[model samples]
Each structure stands twice: as C-alpha cells, then as structure tokens.
Target: MANFNEDGLKKKLDDLNMSQQSIQTVSLWLIHHKKHAHTVVNVWYRELITATDSRKLTFMYLANDVIQNSKKKGPEYNKEFGSKLGKVFEHLGALRLDEKSLRGLNRLLNVWEDRSVFDADHIKLFKKNLNKGHGKSKENNSRKRELGGKHDNPQSKKRRDSASDAIQPSTPESRLRRDSEGDLTQFAVSPQSSTPPSDPPEPEQLIEAIQELENAATSDALVREKIANLPDEVSDVNLLNKLQDLAAGRALCDQVEEALSMLEAYNKRLAEEMEARKAVARMLHDYIAFQKDLLAQAEETLEEHRQKQGKVKKVREELKAHLQNLPDISKLPSIRMGGLAPLPSAGDLFT
Candidate 1:
C-alpha cells in the first residue's frame, strides 16, 4: 500500500532512463496488454488466482518477488538497478513466482535497474525480499480453526500454539522454495513427530474409498466382481428408462442385423459346398458307368474273335485235306485260276 500500487508502479517506471522513444513504446505495450500488466501485480487479481481457499496468491507471489529482487547474475547486469524496480520484482516474487516464473524479468530488469546485483548472493537477497511487504494484507487467520472456531481470531492459547507450531524455520535451502505469506503454509516444514495426522479427505475421494471398502467387505464374490466390472460414466438409475428406450430403437436393430448378416453368410457358404459335392457325385457316377460299358464291350469282342478263330482253323484244315486228295498241282491250279481273291487293307484296323 505504501510504495506499490498501479500509480506508484507507473511513476517508478516513468522516472527511469527515458530514451524518448521508449516512453511511447512502453505506453503502447501497456495499453495493448493492460489487463495482463495489471494482473501481474493486481491485488484483486489474487481472487482469480487463489483456489477455493481464501488464501491469496500469497506464497506464490512472495516466492517470485524474492527471486526477482535477489537479481544477482541471471538478468542483464550492465545498467544500474533501482529500489522501485526492485520493489516491482519483489511484488511479483511475493506472489510465488520462482526461478522459473520471472525468466523474462532478467532482460526487463536491465532496462530498469539503477545498480548492479550479483549472482553469488541471489539466494540471500531473495530471503531479504520476503521480509519486505508487497502492498498486500499480512495477518494470521487460523486462530479460529485451532481454538474456538469463529470468523474472528478466537483468543485462545491452544490455537495460538497450533498456529505458531506450523511456522517452519526459514533456512537457506527451505527459504529458496517457500512463499508462505499468510497464516501457515502447508509445505513449510516436516514435523518432528514420528507420525502425523492426515487431513480429512474430500467428499468425492471419500465416497469412492467407502464404496471400494464396501465392495471388498462383500461376502458374495460374484456380486463384488460385478460391481467392480461396472463401467465408469454409466447410465444412472434415474436415466435407466431412457437408456432402455434407446436400446429398443435403432441400437437393437443394428445388433439384430449384424447377427442375421453373419448367419446368411454361413448359409451361402453351406449351399455352395452342397452344390459342389453333388456335381462331383454326378461326374463319378457317369465315369463309372462309362468304364462298365467299355469293359463289357471288350469281353464280347474277345469272345467273338475266339469263335471266328475256330472257324478259320477248321476251314484251313479242310483245304489242306482237299489239296492232298486232289489231282496234280498244275492241273488244279489251272482250274482255280478263273477268279482272283480280294485282300483287306492294313489301315482299316485302327478305324
């Protein structure tokens, strides 16, 4: 509140080494990103920044200011750095910006510093920055919780001790990471006790854990298994009727059609196999009948040839006997020479 508000900040920036052009440049940049500029240091901005807890961006801002004010070696170091410039960095550090947050602050710091800062003393300077205020409220608010539970600071010894107990020692190592600005920061220090009481769980997480335990305690394994198998984001019992109706519509039809298509494909394959089997059977039957006919014809022809052979042999024997009993050969030949005998051609056998 004393040295850091929008007007204070703007005035501080205005007094710096003003190259005539930089004044316009900085003004235009501020106007264009005015909201962002404000948010960087706005106390009201903490409302959006904080979670459900009323705790402002206390630790986070505090951390950032410390790192930036420390301004040792990282940023541009040629120009002299200043107290107001240091204050702006401190304000940001108070909001918990760490080494990671104010990376751009280095170059910007060079453009604004009145003196040079060192890299070796970065950690020490940061701790000093935390001791300074950033125009934000800094009061302990946990007395009500540990003591008489009121909106106001309940005057009680036990609550005071509990709140004090939460305060961690600021060491070189611990201080580097912390920005605990108000009340007590959760990640401040490890407790000396062997065991610590765990905080109460959120409603959603507790509900899930209770359901899991109930499932585990069930006697019927099948019921437990079914519950486990339940899909996430299921249709609630409240919407069961709607889901049932949807199933009855196109969804059910799609399932039936898919099943029928599979059955039809199977039937088609079965029919084709039956036709192929029948065709093969017909071909086999015809082939067997043809072979039987061929074998019968061969047997009949062989029998006929046998009979003809017998007749031919008998005729030859009679002719030989006739010749033997006939007159002289020259006389018989002259008598039979009246007609010539005809012969069959050799090519006629294959036909």
Candidate 2:
C-alpha cells in the first residue's frame, strides 16, 4: 500500500519538479502518519481505496508539478495554470490536522506497493523528503537557535529562562525539567501556541489560496488578462467572444442560457413591431380609401338632384306669381306682354 501511494505521489513530484515546499504537503501528511501511528514498515497503499471522498483526497493529494522557477526554466506558457497547480500546496498547508486525516494517511500508505506509477527520480525525491521527517523539528530548532542558541532559532534565551523558573524541588518528575535545561516538552507552549507559525502561513493555507488565485487566472492566461483589463464599453464584446468559445465548448451550458435570453428579448421586440406595422397596413386598406370614395359619390349625387329641383321650384314660383298678377292686369289691360321669355318646355315639367 505504501509503495502504491509512493509511486503515484513520486511521479507527480518529479513531473512538477516543483520546490520542496510544493511537494512538502504530501510529505507532511506522510510524516504526520509516520510519527504518530502504527506506520507499516513496507509498501505504500492505493490512494483511492483509503479515501472516503476522492475530492478531499485529491485536494490534499495532487502535487504541483510545475516548478516555481523562472518561466524560462519552467513551463514556457500558461503560467497561470502552472501556478494554480502550485496552489494545492498552500491549501494542504491550511488544513487542520485531525483523526480523519490520519485515516487518509493510513489508506495512502496501505496501497503504495503494487501501483508503481512513479519513475525512479520521483521515488528518490519522495524518500529524501520523507526520511528528513517533518520540517518542523529543523525549522523549530533553527528558530530557537536564531533567538539565542548557536542555532538559527530566535527564542532560546527566553526558553532557557522559563526552564530555570519552572524548576521544582527534587521530585522525580520535576528533575527532568530541572536537569534538562532545554527540554522543549517542558517549555510549556500554550495550547494555542502549539500551533504552527502564523507569520509564514501554513503549507495548507498557501496551497488553497494559491490554487484559488491561479484558478481565477484560467487555462489561457494571455486571453484572460485581456478580458480582465477590457474597457467597460468592450466588456460585453469580450463576453461575447467567450460565449462564442463556450458554445464550442458546449459544456458551459450557462453561457448558452444567457445567449438565449438576449435572443429572446430581441425576438419579442421584433414581434411587437411587426404586429404594429400590420395594424397600420390594415388601417390604410380598410378605412381611409372607402370613406373618401363614399363621400365623393354622395357629393356628386346631391349636386345633380339639387340643380334639377331648383329649376322646377323656380318655374312653380313664377307661375304662382303670374296667377296673382292676372287680376291686377285685368284692371290695366293696356299693358301688353307679347315679348315675355318662353318657359313652356315639356321636358321641364314633372312627368
């Protein structure tokens, strides 16, 4: 089991060729298991078998294969993707150790034998790190020395003073603290202080944050940077380009949905305008010309009837006047009328 896990882990470490800090996550998990548990002396285990959730395992398990060296020495392109992979180390560093993690480690060690996925170089790298133990002891020691000891530690003097102060009478157990002046176990790191360093950040935190930063960078950093910096006016244009590519991808169904919504809105407006134009066309065809023709015919008929009626009415009125004047004329028969205008046309009478 140990061999199986080792082989796969080793391959990843070599492939990334990342800094020891990057691969150090898996190493740390292993060391935690190595020091604390009934660690098998032999082969490592399969990664899948031991993990309750593949995602959780992958979260802590996958190593950043891309070395953080200069771009020239490292991957030539897509540095963001490379960096994203490196972020896993930071995430692993952030995780708080617990019993569940121990189970994962046990599973990891149990399956390392049969699955020899790693090449020789990666396997060698793994051994180097694993054999070195967790970097804590060395780093802690360095810190202590840098404080005051000849070592790189920064707290040696204070630690020594505390040791002197805690001294008790010649009780059997008290003798250890009294005799062993620099016993770290007796140094009484607070329950809170027993935690890893806060300033440098844990390897897990580094992995998680770095991964997120890198994830935000995306697969193609070149195009991505442009999209990020695009002017507000051209922002939609950038999105349109992405939507076009996403359509090709077909996997980003959300883009398709958004495009569909825009198209639907356009279609709705077009349909409304088409209905309005159709109503206008109907108004022209049904009402305007019909009313004008009807009015014109009515005007001509009324004019013709009015002229004929007026002629008849004029003749009748003149006849009535003549009748009334006949008696008057009788009294004055000397008034002659032989040259009067003729009005005896038969066609003018009401037939």
Query: Which regions of candidate 1 deviate over 4 angstroms?
Result: 1-263, 324-328, 331-351
**Global lDDT of each model?**
0.37, 0.36
Give per-residue CA lDDT, model 2, range 177-226, as digits (tens): 42233433232212121111111223454445445443331344554464
How well does each candidate superpose onto the true structure, as a TM-score?
0.20, 0.22
Report per-prediction Cα RMSD to one decimal: 50.0, 48.8
Error of 1 at 290 (Å): 4.8
Candidate 2 regions exceeding 4 Å error are 1-256, 328-351
Candidate 2 similarity to native, TM-score: 0.22
Clash numbers, per candidate: 26, 53
